[model samples]
Target: MNAQTKQDLLISIPNLSGYDSETRVLMERACVSERGNGPVAYGACLNRQIASLQGAPGIPNLSGYDSETRLLMERACVSERGNGPVAYGACLSRQIASLQGAPGIPNLSGYDNETRLLMERACISERGNGPVAYGACLNRQIASLQGATGIPNLSGYDNETRLLVERACISERGNGPVAYGACLRRQIDSLSTLPGSQ
Candidate 1:
């Protein structure tokens, strides 16, 4: 993060402290831990924090701070952290789509490997693939789909990516010869109830 960015985030720190427990834990986890952290390191940390904060329920009402936060989060997830930003970034992505028990999930504009992993895991979980399987399931990432039951949370992804993910998730289920109808229905139902959507 630049000096200006740092100052901006610092100003929001007090607001962050007011967030609920889950958001606070998530924000802290976005930063990379190192005794020898540099500007790049600081940027990574800041990006993760911003991503988590933007996904919080109250972000929409945060007085335009949400846009600044979303930009920083995207820069970190898509550019700086590479794979490292995935875990934190994806958490915010999934939450962005839903964020239960609150006002709404804020709009997050970008995605990373972490967020893709989140989609896969969520798809798998909903498919009743109970115990998460590492290599046993799927590790692929998809971007967009036309009629996917449950829509993903990224606005910048192309349509093809969405379809790919939906297909990949289904293949990973490895269940009986059932149709895809139920899965799609559940996904649609779930997404319609997400924070912003609801």
Candidate 2:
């Protein structure tokens, strides 16, 4: 993937809290192998990596890892070959806690309907404003993700190009289509008088 796309994928990965710079870099490199796949595939790759890290010899404990990594490892261990509700619920709780600013809660689609409901309840109890916080956090995350795409350099664009660029920027910031169209209109109006406007 290109650098910008790679960065966007990285930002969308959950469970990164409390990682040291070096460990974070290592995990990013690990994710390189999982690129080009969508988010669910990437998450599966991450879970596999967590399982591998948990099983490696001489790393008996995950004390050196971040809390997020440690919690993921714990979840992996708990869910291994077991469908026990208590263990699953505990794992879900830890997953929720580890993902404070994640895009949203981890997908529970793999669970049965009943289990999914329980997990949602557990998440809600763990985070009182879970859905609201998730929306706000997702917006901030999108802004940061797009900020890495180097979209701010619209210096030499003509009116049409600037309008398209503005629409893209506003949309990537999570604004609605109406806002995007308005932004495009405003950009077209403002840039029409610029020195190089066509």
Candidate 3:
């Protein structure tokens, strides 16, 4: 990833500073890995690394949770294995709190079903990254879809090039809003300087 993409990924992690030193280091290392995966994959990698260091936490009883919630929790815990049990558990707890209207997570209830599902998928994609990372990830996705950031102007390009630029920008959506806009601006800059692109 480019610097802008890396920066966007870093900022999308909620309350990043609140994480312990080791966890923070793990996240940063994952961000720059050659795997070149999106934020969600990076988060999952972090979970695995943490689990490896700490050994997996024993499974907790899930009798109290409804089937859906229990399944969600089970999948989460199982995904992390024994890596960083504390971080993994805390992330799941934060998700539960968000569902219950806790202050940290945004109110996503009002969005259309499709948009809501996208946001939920965004969060789940980063499931093991912890509350702060996935919380911020969901917020960024919502904001991007809502057009909180302005799209770059592509009027200077021909139809074919413009279509390509738009598609390129959208492909960076997983990196968050900043990277999307940056991708557009980068394309505009690079393409405009080409001999015939003007």
- C-alpha local distance difference test of each model: 0.42, 0.47, 0.59
**lDDT top scorer:** 3
Clashes (N, CA, C under 3 Å) per candidate: 11, 0, 8
lDDT, candidate 1, residue 114? Answer: 45
Model 1, span 1-198: residue lDDT tens: 699988865653434456555445544544446214755556556555656445344322223335533443343334323333335445345434432333322222354444444544544433221111221233222222223333335344357755654565575333311223345445556656769975
Assess candidate 1 and give its TM-score to the true structure. Answer: 0.23
RMSD of each: 20.3, 20.9, 18.8
Q: Can you list the residue pairs that collide in candidate 2?
A: none
Error of 2 at 78 (Å): 33
What are the TM-scores, per candidate, against the unseen true structure? Answer: 0.23, 0.22, 0.37
**Per-residue lDDT of model 3, residues 58-105, tens digit only:** 234457766645555555555443344454555556545555642234
Model 3 poorest 10 in a row by lDDT? 51-60
Model 2, 1-198: lDDT tens digits are 899887766656667555544444445556655657877576666555555545233113346555544554454534321422233334445544654655543444654453334334333323333333433433443343342322234556777786676655554233332333345556657767889867
lDDT of 1 at 25: 54
